[model samples]
Target: MRVPVVVKVGLFALAVMGIYTYYANSIPQIQSALPEEISLEAETVTPEQLVRVGEELFKGKGTCEVCHRIGQVGARAPDLAGIGGRAGTRRPGVSPTAYLVESLLQPGAYVVEGFPNIMPRVDRPPIGLNRSELWAVVAFLESLGGEVRARLDDIPKTAGVPAGEAPVAELKLPGDPEAGKAIFMGKGGCVACHKAGPLGASPVGPDLSEIAKIQTPEYIMAKILNPAAMGTVAGYPAGVMPPTLGQTLTAKEYVDLVSFLLTLKGGA
Candidate 1:
């Protein structure tokens, strides 16, 4: 008996789907890993514990291991071996601990010789770390070859963000600052390079707490829409910010983020 054309077609279709399913399953899947929140109870954490957590952050959330190496030469960043001892000498009048904080917060402040300035502030988004986590990273770096004297106070708190609140830019722009903040910390990922508070204190938040007070409203708007045209900050890398930011965000998101940024008076 001859198979009906419809039945043969159905079988072929099923076989094609089966092969597709098999092929798809055979291919390895890729997924981006989001960093886990690192929380340390400061009152109860010990120096050793801090170092361990710091190591974890260095390896994980901090993403330092991507460009840094413990004892080997880093093609991207500097070899961190004995960095604790050498950190003080990196800059005159800057102590080992102070230098570490500065590097984590203001990566462009000091670029290592022969290395391009590309290190992002660990306290900012993507790697957004709170004060305690930043302290842990510093302690971890110090543990390599120097004294782990990094203190919690070394990290400064943003003005209005200490309470997880956005600053009162009180601008006439019609956008929700709170919603914009969510975009900053969420979709916009602006917190990665700029801080509008809420990242939790000094060295931990990437330190752009006073953007509104320092920048004019017109400049802020233009900067967000066309960063390359606005020009880079003195110490930061040129073209570091995404030029596609305006394209990526919805109009409301862009407005909200701008309104939120305008409110960041850094406690006036």
Candidate 2:
């Protein structure tokens, strides 16, 4: 008696799936959990502690290194090797602390020569560094080549509005969510880092199972076009999201992907 073709095909598919699942589970997993907000107003934090927290934000939430490099010149932004020491000198009338604070709150105001004025305001959404976070970041920058003189008051009161509540431009996407899900699992490479319901199990980036519930459609679209500008999600390393998704994907594909992402409202 000959074995049935259907049975053989089913066995082969199962074997392949088992191998893939085993390999995925065997790899090192890195979950990108969201960072908790820090409030310095109520707590008494020392300068040393502040600087430490500032450094973490720079690499994590602030997402400064995505463009600005320390000790090395960057392609996107200026090398901040001596920003602290020369910040005061950049604008003769302004002090170093004031300069740093201004630079973070209003990056486009003083675009460094040779680099485009693409740096987003750190206090704005996506990156959304809060007042306390901004204060610490300035302290960290000052430590590079100048003294730490930044205070809580240095950061503008209006800066660092929480991103979730911020107003976003209304978008009307005209792409199929089902096709977008296919692209997400195949060409988009999002499944490798993010977990979107049943599509993925990777822990490399933040779980996007509930992304639509928390983020606005405008933010999602902008983030796809400019990951660095949107800023790194807290707890995830900076520069991990590819910045070329906007260019690599066709306009329709981009819209479809965004549409699919919008459907991921958690709990499937």
Candidate 3:
């Protein structure tokens, strides 16, 4: 998808990650960094220490920066530069701490404008952050533009996997990306509406040049089969993409399409 012009913010916001620097010479290294279980079990961990660990979790295990960045106007999620202060005002009568906690634990409770309500709950499986980890992440976010007053008790101990939720990210299908590109530009008719970098420029759908960066592989797979259930991008009409994609494409074609989409993390 096409990323909008990024409005540069403060130094904190301008801390563009080394690997994500666009149009660079070297190719990026793509590999899985499984969630490393961090045990912050002691209550004696300082607020400053928690903030440090939270920063690590956000960048690494939490995989937050894949969708959110500090300075840039986020395409998938909200710009978290001054979120420490902006969060309190997100919902009336909602404290900054409460807002952050609810946003992470229950993302759909309050969706930001222009962004879809596709945020998966951070406390669930796959991204299961323990109670203390939740406290640390919230503390780290609070430190962004406000005072760090989040105590360990701010996060609920019962926050865990729902009864029926599955680990969607674990599903792996090695589809040929080259074959998928063909399906996208020709057979799949994706290029008719969507913009895949310089491949197409139809305003009918959102630019998908960076879909992999902002979304998960499973989401892209499911969206093709059922666009309505995945939710639509803001400013775009819903029910436009064909709902019969699953029935229309052969199993090989579907796999190839997802493989191609997964490689769209910007041409750099």
Candidate 4:
């Protein structure tokens, strides 16, 4: 007896699915996981070890290879083959270490003649490198053709600040600014480091007196979730902002805090 057309179609579908499943299972399974934060503050690392770590970060977490190429010209960024040796001479009266640190921290401060100001601050969230990582990366870059003399102190205290440009569109959060302000001062302990309009008076972190005016809501939210990825504000220390705020606060609490921050518009 002839089988129904539906049965034939079903069988074909089953076979296709089975083949796909088998093929998927046969291939190597590669899982992409987020890079873990590394700190060498307390650890004693040699120059060689530091360079190795820096190389890994550049290729992996630092994402430097995305735009910067060594030896060859890049479409987005300058080739870094001899950036170490060339860094000092690029600016008048600037040391190689200082120039490199500034390039990483405040890329827009001095744009290379042919390149656009597109480099992100390395010490902030998204690429939120700590002092240790920054030190290592600088050393790695310096080793390209120059001396590896970049120290932990070379990176400025306020190296990473959220980009000053506002978002194309604003986000409307369903949170109470009053509640967020309360959390900032009391439960969140943000007031200990940051200076908001009237709630906080701390000098340890960047002043948020006008954060809402300068940054996008998306940036503020992302910074809260992943401060390292967002980058540090210039003139502030890296890694001081804990990366645990997303995990520590409830959804409402986080939203409320962001709303409160958005209210801060310096002189606006």
Candidate 5:
């Protein structure tokens, strides 16, 4: 069928416009609407300059490496490998940036479960950090996941003891499994580890819901009170566990903690 020239051209134009509209609509609207992840590349500062300024306060004035590790081998501090992703999940009620800032400024608030609350609160005098220096350490910690892109020169190279030096003796404290749960979740902060059925636990540390099935109450008590004696595993970091919890806890608290820990069971 021979169509009129003007009509033919009009139909062709309409078909083109319709095809354009269909394809446009078919494109994912969310992709177009969503914002790209902005690169947080540092401003143009020399690598040496960044390290000097960053490490000066961090390792020297700040003394971060005293407890924290950069390359997975320091004493009493959770290794900072993949900490940029972990800090958010490990400690609830904290984002990556906010968690980093809060940790530096207030070290004891939400401790890395199983570790002692020994990290003196940085908010107090004689050991406080101003805002900028704290953030710089955060930036450096956030940067440590991959190859250490920054020069950690200021971080002293002294080799720390492979494991914590705390002595490990039989747990003298006595408590029941039922009672231990109370002290654990309440006083001893045992909920930080030993999760079962979504009750209380943290992945950065060990799970104790099945300890009773595996180890005796005395063994469990000794291990809990003296984590250094227990040693390390794949997920759990070594030496970071506080071996002095026995000293800090009362006999009753110890009993209660041990009692609660024994309640953990495998296979539900």
Candidate 6:
């Protein structure tokens, strides 16, 4: 049977369209339905008030948008879209908001899986945050995580000590921003994943444009040593960040590395 050329063309086009639609929608839907075996407490906030406050805090003084991604703008970090979902499977027993608080206060405590542990410690900066500012930043991060699968309430609010309060620092190495840059790229191994100015690092992680202004030293160190402990925050996959490479360095090295990290502050 000789089919008309137009008929054959039309059928081919329809088949192609059908395949595209199925791949685009159905695959995702089925994957969503599949059991990922995740465990994460959902987040709860004041809604409009928290979101508005978080938006301003994140974009403004927080300067989180510089390295981290929110609703467009910056890059060098993972997209915040559906952070709640990512955290659930990746960080079991961790709340999205709590995870954010930990990340800000201790960037090194729990490095995301698959990514290099490169986020400089926030402690390098002298900007010690008061209680209110800390809460505000945490709130903003939680908002980004959005409503998770399990109710956040299910997870204990006090999963760990409040961020920015840990006495993790023992040595006193006066930080030099200039020297810190060298240490970051050199011994610290931070240059492997983080980019600074013309010095480009790997895209597998976030950038260090103006991290000093956004994070506290305590937060930075925690992220360095144990990012998994921080869980998932700002929707970055908790498992994505590696644990702090503390075992790799000595006490003095830790102090020196931290001092160098502090100099990375100020707007990029």
Return the top candidate by TM-score: 3
Error of 3 at 116 (Å): 1.1
The TM-score values for the models, in the order shown, are: 0.48, 0.55, 0.62, 0.48, 0.35, 0.40
Which residue segments of model 3 deviate by more than 4 Å? Answer: 1-35, 160-186, 189-218, 234-244, 251-268
Question: Which pairs clash inside model 3?
Answer: 1-207, 1-208, 1-209, 1-210
lDDT of 5 by residue, 162-197 (tens): 112222222222347666667767667656654654
Q: Following a full C-alpha superposition, what root-mean-square deviation does model 2 have from the true structure?
A: 15.1
How many collisions per candidate? 5, 0, 4, 21, 11, 40
User: Model 2: per-residue lDDT, tens digit, 1-268?
Assistant: 9966544543543453355345433431211223476777668888888889999988776767655678885224678888889898888789999889989878767867655455666664445677788899999999888988788888877766432333333233567899999889999899999899887899777778766544445557667777888765544678898876755676667768878997875564
Misplaced by over 4 Å in model 6 are: 1-58, 67-173, 176-179, 232-244, 266-268
Q: Which candidate model has the greater lDDT, 2 or 6?
A: 2
The lDDT of each candidate is 0.65, 0.71, 0.71, 0.69, 0.49, 0.50
**Superposed Cα deviation of residue 12, candidate 3 (Å):** 47
lDDT of 3 by residue, 1-268 (tens): 7532222211212232222233121321222333455667655888899999999989866768757888886245677998889889989999999999999988989988777788767764335566777888999999999989898777776764322333333333467889999999998999999988778989788788867655655467667877888888656788899887666676677777878887786655
Question: In model 2, which residue pairs have backbone atoms overlapping below 3 Å?
Answer: none
After the best TM-score superposition of candidate 3, give how far the Cα of residue 187 lies from its true spot, in angstroms: 3.9
RMSD of each: 20.9, 15.1, 13.5, 20.6, 25.6, 20.8
Tell me the lDDT of candidate 1: 0.65
- Candidate 4: tens digits of C-alpha lDDT, residues 153-223: 78665553222222122334567999999889888889999888776688887677866544445557667
Candidate 5, superposed: residue stretches over 4 Å from native: 1-52, 146-268
**Which has the better lDDT: candidate 4, or candidate 6?**
4
Tell me the lDDT of candidate 3. 0.71
Give the winner by TM-score: 3 or 6. 3
Taking all chains together, the TM-score of candidate 6 against the true structure is 0.40
